[model samples]
Target chain A: MSSTLIALAAVCAANPFRVAACAPTSTDIRRQAVAVATALSVAAVGLLAVLSEAILDWLNVSGSSSRIAAGAAVLVVGTRDLFIQPPSPEPALQGWRAGIVPMGFPVILTPALAILAISAGSERGAGTAVGMIGAAILVVAVIAVGNIRGTYWRTATVGSAGVVFGTLLLLNGVTAI
Target chain B: MSPVSTRVVRGVLAWILVLGVVALVVHPEGCGQPSSGEVNEAAVATVAWFGANINDDGTFVYRYDRAENRPLGGYNDVRHAGVLLSLYQAESAGIEGAAEIADRGLAYVDERLLNTPIGLVFGRGASARSGSVGLLVAALDERRWATGADDRDPLLLALGRTLTGVVNADGSVGASINTATGSTSGRSPFFTGEVLWALARLHLTFPDENFDEPALRVYRYLIEDRDRVESPWPPVSDHWGAYALETMSRWPNADDLQLEPDLELDGPATRQWLARQLGLFGLQVRYESQRQGGITRLTRGTVALPAGVGTLGEGIGNYLRFLDRFEVTDIDVDALNERTNCVAHLLTNRQVSAAQAQQYAEPLRVQGAWFRNDITQMDDQQHALSALLLLEDWMPQ
Candidate 1:
């Protein structure tokens, strides 16, 4: 697999959905605002994708090593989330800050996500890999708003997909006998 | 689905993931970089594979089908000689029983020799290949070196002369000799190097003979003409060139060794050529390291055939021998050493283990060999064995 896509599946599995769901905005405005924030996340991710080749060259790292590094970072994040119930990450905020805060920052633009973005871009083309993530985030934002139930229950499907996919990508990178 | 059940399903999956990962960790036999001890064990197993498969009639299985549990047809005398060389090398390295097995293989090749104007070449009539004859000389020479015996000197001199019979004045080498006519014809990029290597070894064995001249002349042809004139795309990575230098590097008073002046060969020039050859090998090792069974294949390219990668190991191991004895400038010894070890690591990772071989109908035929899918060839073991033995000491303890 493109280690990046496995990483993408790892970081995106349930993160944006929960982040969008827990957004403090009213449901009416939430989808539009999440869309805006998600587009911004896609841009930032695309930026990393464009720079990934240069970044790797500067660091004297190869594409395979970069993929492993990205897998490792995503794995750690996913594994941590699996054991500890990750809080609905961003705090409650008012105005346009709601979109930019939780959804744009940590929920959408997480460290694991950034690593996956660069890796995907490096492995596949930036246009395709980042576009896939952009498309995924856009879809997750709509689902998050439409499916929100209650803060106590948290629309609550477990996002073990990240953990599962992270494990898959990590093992795939392991040289086999 | 209700939220409660959804949460329960997710919880179940999380626990299952944990259990699955645990299962993998506990039973991951033969994965990742093998320790130096494992590398030693791996080499022993590979040597065992050669000993186990040499047929009663002196030939070997040639190729084998693990899934079908049958010996594949066809054999190359060149590979036979190559394997024999590895056995002798193993014997030299303190591998028990290797010399006995090598002696048996040597006798088999000895029976196939054709008396030619060049001396005695292996194979009969029109089908004889000088490459095989070349490797036979090297194998016989390897045994003599290992045991310090001259009992084979008459045969070695005859076979060594057989290699020179094919060489023209400008260092061009014909790979095959027409036994009926006592003539050598045809050019092979591969035979070119192996023959050159054999000639170099011949020079060392009896420095008084004309063996050193052809050996030096062949080195000149190899470094200058083969690629630009013949132009095999992606150019040939001549492991035999490295092997020849290794043989020469071990010569007494090697530091002051001199080649014919008109041949334009010198220590600095030889060192540079070897360093370049090693560069090609290092690149191949790195590329092989990137190969995976997943989509990474789309990016990294599919895994190479086992023997092809194994040659990289052989090349690096031999070239490293050159570097160690001579001062090759602008090379990173540690990085080069690490890359050499990476080939061993790659070979070790790809080799069929005892556990995995049990899935085959015949496990003995399966273990200690590398297969592309279901089939493994003689050179796969031949090169991997030579590589493991050649590079064994450089790997960390």
Candidate 2:
């Protein structure tokens, strides 16, 4: 498979806010924030997909190299996710602003994820958009599981999923060369 | 939020290093790199192929479609000179029998020279293109440089005159001379670069001759006018341009020659752009490596013709030689070397081996030849030989 789905899956798998379900914020607010983040991500990634051709022309790189770079972006996040603790974004920020900041910007829709979307989207077109939607669904499901199943689920995911998928992400990127 | 321990990071890094080392050992060509020894051997085999294929009368098996098991009918006059030039390069590389093989090829070219009003050209056809004349000059220059043989000096000078006729006063290049009319017509940027290289080499051999001014003007045309007047976007892949640029680097006070009263040459910019073109050639090599049959071909694209692919080697190889010979410090030498090495590695890896050639209907036809879509032309070896010989020193051990 192309690096698109792999990168998307890796991004979801390494989502820092998988444990955000355990936060004291109300479930409606949390879901609303996630939905807003997803919308913003879709809009930005869509733009990147369209502009990818022009961007590549400007940079004097190819679609293949960009995809390779997309894979490398995953590796960068993979290292961060494997080692560093997920940022504890305070609840002092309310509404969709949380989605714009900690959730959209860092947790769900990350730099690596954006790169993957742009490259994969440019290369495979609808295939990447479909993968992005699939990843968003998976990320939401992980959080839902954490909310329903409580701290035990959150602890298990935080302890294992990031390390496992983060390693996979690194492998995915390494395979690019 | 705690970061992973330094000890853990160190342990992980150690494992990665171990895995990487093992991977490299298991499949050394993983990065598309080959040692110098293999490339040198391949170069010998290619020259041997040339030696084996030459007819008693000096004609080569110009184009062979292996699947058809027959020699395809067509001959390129420029390629005749080209093959001779490669043989000279091979001889310089110390490959045995290369000079002898080149002597036969040179005889064929000598017999084909047709005199025109301006000077003698290589063909008796309706038109004798400047490119063929230019290549003829280059081939002669290579022979002289390799063996110090000046017996054919008259023929070389005559061809140099023909090429000079194609170079206009303003440095722009004409396409060809009408053999009957004795008139020059058309414009070709590529033909101009070929002439430019010929003039540069001619100047080196006969420094007292006025070949330098023509060469400088052509160089100026390439830098300033070729793009505007002749070809547009998706510029030609120019091994000749690379050769000309590199040869210019060796000229006495090359910087002084780089200037004109009305137009100042941007030497660094031209080198960078030409270097970028070489990188484009390297890109083709990389993409070609990625291509495979079945579903992979659909994704990665079809294999490039071996002649076309061989030019990738020629482009980067000449550029590398340019970099090393002149030691021009403007471009990133390390990166250029790496790109050159990678192309050498991939080309060497992809070349037909003896054992593999045994499976073909005619071993000689298939042996030591690079084919794409089962078709191998004379130039597949010609360009590859030039590239391989020039690339020998730069290759990683």
Candidate 3:
């Protein structure tokens, strides 16, 4: 039990999902992986709004007004992005530096990840939560390098797939609510 | 390039080689004398010079000429007190002038100085002043043990008693004492640890029941019952934690106290922590490069300057000093070397007026700058002194 606990703690603390994904496989690989991971994580955060109720019921959690409020915030952001006319590409390109800025920071691994951490921790115990986080980090690492040389269609497909998955999660959350 | 210019460049290169050799010769490593011996000699010179100049009452005019003669005067008391404690660690160590240095240092401490809290010790002069007292207490305790003196020097005894007064009924030491109102500041780990380390040493030396009570209380306050609600630990509290843990480890009956393993990270763990902390030192180098890349300074900045760019230099210096005293080896000396070289480069290249650099960077010179700068000197001197004492102790005499 102690060893299990230790392993869990190590996983949680290690956050391997982010770690594996974040490693610089190569410059080209880094850029592609980060783009895919960022789109997915952001979409995941957005889908939380649609699936908030389900998430709460599934986890058997309550009295987290703050969590609901945060979900609303993510919903507003995702909705705005979906509706708003796309801005000039130059500014967007300048904004998202490869692996250093949004991709490294708030996008792939962020406060939402931390929130997921807290939820995972409270529900499944700290060790399991940490392990999940590690898994997520590993996922990020794989995605970071794997998508680098893919064509624009492949990149768009990955982004579209993330949006679809996020929408499904959102629907589940709402049904649960 | 012209022949004359080429010749001049060659001359400069040759001169640089010569200077490098000279520096290496002057500060040789692994020599029979040990590094701490050099530090001790420097510290003693600082103390003796201060004693001669700063009258018994701890008041003196700042004479730049006299200051030039003893450039280390600003840091003399604090650095000397630290070295005195280091010297106390040596087997067959002499405590010849430690008492006098302690007396001179203690004369400055009063209710007014005692009122300032620990965090403010950096901004206010209280930490440096109180820290000197702490060092002296540790030194005097060692002196008493070495000499088998039943009654310690009266001044030293008085100072020890005064330190006790700094502690309140609760384990905390009042930040500073209001001389007029006789009031004290709120309790803090930084002050409490300084007081505790000193009191712990004194208790070990004399086995006083009175000292033990507060010492234990302070120890508990600092370690077991830290402010976990707001920020896992209190700010400016880790230094105290490190000091308390290290000092406790040295106690004859330390095994009685069940300290947490995490708090008492072993040498390797501690060294790793030290390495991570060195990253901040690296950041400071980056910050310096950004700030002064194109700027020119009069004096080629070197290792001897008093300005501390960041907490990393101070942290590295403190940790190294602690490690040396604890006799913990297996440290990543290469990492330390890299960090030290970074700091050396910063100091050497730091843009300062020719006059200021001339005065500040002179060997053994102390600036009237903040105590952080002064602490760098104290930390370096003590680490060196401890290393020397360790070497001397192990020497096959």
Candidate 4:
């Protein structure tokens, strides 16, 4: 959605959205979306490097098979983004409800991201996971403040595009391997 | 000011004024002159006598006379070789009389007893060689004091080196070889104890870099070696044990000394043992009866029992001297008093001829009768002058 893209763009411009991705706050829906996306990126990078083998084992897949699957998923997302036109403009929401689903769930809590969260929870125990989640929420609340300005969205648009291109290269590399 | 505060301030001011007046009236130079000079002179004389009696080969003869010697020999015969070494060294140092005595004694030892253990036992199986090393070390220090001589005797150095070699790494010195056949069977605690004492004395006096290790090893063995079980005469050999313990305890580095657990004895136990051997003197008064009633008097031309009481007196005197030297306050004076009382009782009760009593008791007196009566006279006296050296530091100003 246009609204979602604008929120992501705003996050890229205001570094606060990077932190907010792991935490959520009562903020504009687009701001929350940007924060969630940032959290997903962080979790994905962490899982691939630090806990790749454990993640694969937990998913009941070999390391090589998991890498292949991740590459295919990334390729599918990149292709869809590059070729497809969105059908509807995203609806803007003003409060906490908007942050709960799109921003707090899918953007930050994607399937790969969920795997990482589960692995982190298992590694550090449930108490540490709760503490980490609390910290993430605090960070996202602070980041959401920047969403009030339109200039932030313009700058964030370029950054999000860069991230998508990088993610595409990463997927190609994984597929080649 | 309030009346009370004013009174307190005035009182303090008056006290200070009185102290100032007293200090001005008492001259330190006048008070110190006689005792200090006398002590120094006595020290010099004692060192001189030791030097004069030394033989050429590093041993000392009893006296100039050979015919007057008893079978066990004279007091000098028993102790001179060991005592003279310090005297000779003192004389060499420019202590007026000490140099002559040291030279004479050194010459005598060189000529008569070089390379033989005869010097080790000058009287009554008293070890001359082992005792000589200690005496020599003491003499060297005296000679340094007497003649201002800085050059140490190489023979004395060799003697220490040889002793270090004889002592095992574990601290035991091997038994002396039988003169007839150069074979040793078991160790003699007396000889070993004396040797360790000498080594410790040498460390105290000359204090070379090499002496520390061997001295500590020997000290540990003598004071703490339990399972190496070597002493044959337990009762009679106690003086040596006390001597070693006392000497080791006086060493500057004693705190760093570690002994085997089995060998480590508490201070009380060691003190008790020394008390029994030295008589009930000062703090060690538990065994007063043993020395209390024996042969209280001696007469002219009296061939009486050799009341072994003198040994205890001498031992107590030595212990006191050690305590005084080290400034040790943790001693039982009751023990010392009991021993002193016994000796005093013996002396007072005996109706012996003055000359006979003096002759018999002189050697038994801790630092000779002169110092025994008046410590002020201990300066140049030649008996157990070491005791005086220790006491001088503690003397009331």
- Residues A1-177 of candidate 4 have per-residue lDDT tens digits of 112222232232223332233223344654545555445544443444455446434543322222223333323333323332321112222343334333433333333223323333333333443344334433444544454332334324433453463344323222220
DockQ for each model: 0.04, 0.04, 0.02, 0.00
Winner by lDDT between candidate 3 and candidate 2 = 2
What shift in Å separates residue B159 of candidate 4 from its native position after superposition?
A: 0.6
Candidate number with greatest TM-score: 2
Q: Cα miss at B318, model 4 (Å)?
A: 4.5
| Candidate-wise lDDT, in order | 0.70, 0.67, 0.42, 0.40
Whole-structure CA lDDT of model 3: 0.42
TM-score of chain A of each: 0.80, 0.70, 0.40, 0.38
lDDT of 4 by residue, B1-397 (tens): 7543443354356335433432222111101112333444444544533443344554543322112222223334325544554345334434556556555555554543334332221222323344444444445544655565666556556566656655777787665533333223346545566667667766766666467678767766655552246645433524444556666666776644555443333344344454344422321211222222223111111212212223333345456656555443444453244344433333222212234334432322222223221221111133334423332333234
The deviation in Å at residue B141 for candidate 4 is 4.8
Ranking by lDDT: 1, 2, 3, 4
Candidate 1 local Cα displacement, residue A17, angstroms:
41
After superposing candidate 1 on the true structure, give the runs of residues whose Cα lies further than 4 Å from its correct spot.
A1-177, B1-33, B256-268
TM-scores for candidates 1 onward, in order: 0.65, 0.68, 0.43, 0.41
Q: What is the TM-score (0 to 1) of chain A in model 1? A: 0.80
What 10-residue stretch in candidate 1 chain B is worst by lDDT? Answer: B22-31
- Misplaced by over 4 Å in model 4 are A1-177, B1-78, B85-99, B112-138, B141-148, B175-186, B205-208, B225-234, B237-247, B260-314, B321-331, B337-397
Candidate with more favorable, higher TM-score: 3 or 4? 3
Worst 10 residues of 4 chain B by lDDT: B25-34
Q: Which prediction has more favorable TM-score, 2 or 4? A: 2
**lDDT top scorer:** 1
What is candidate 1's TM-score for chain B alone? 0.87
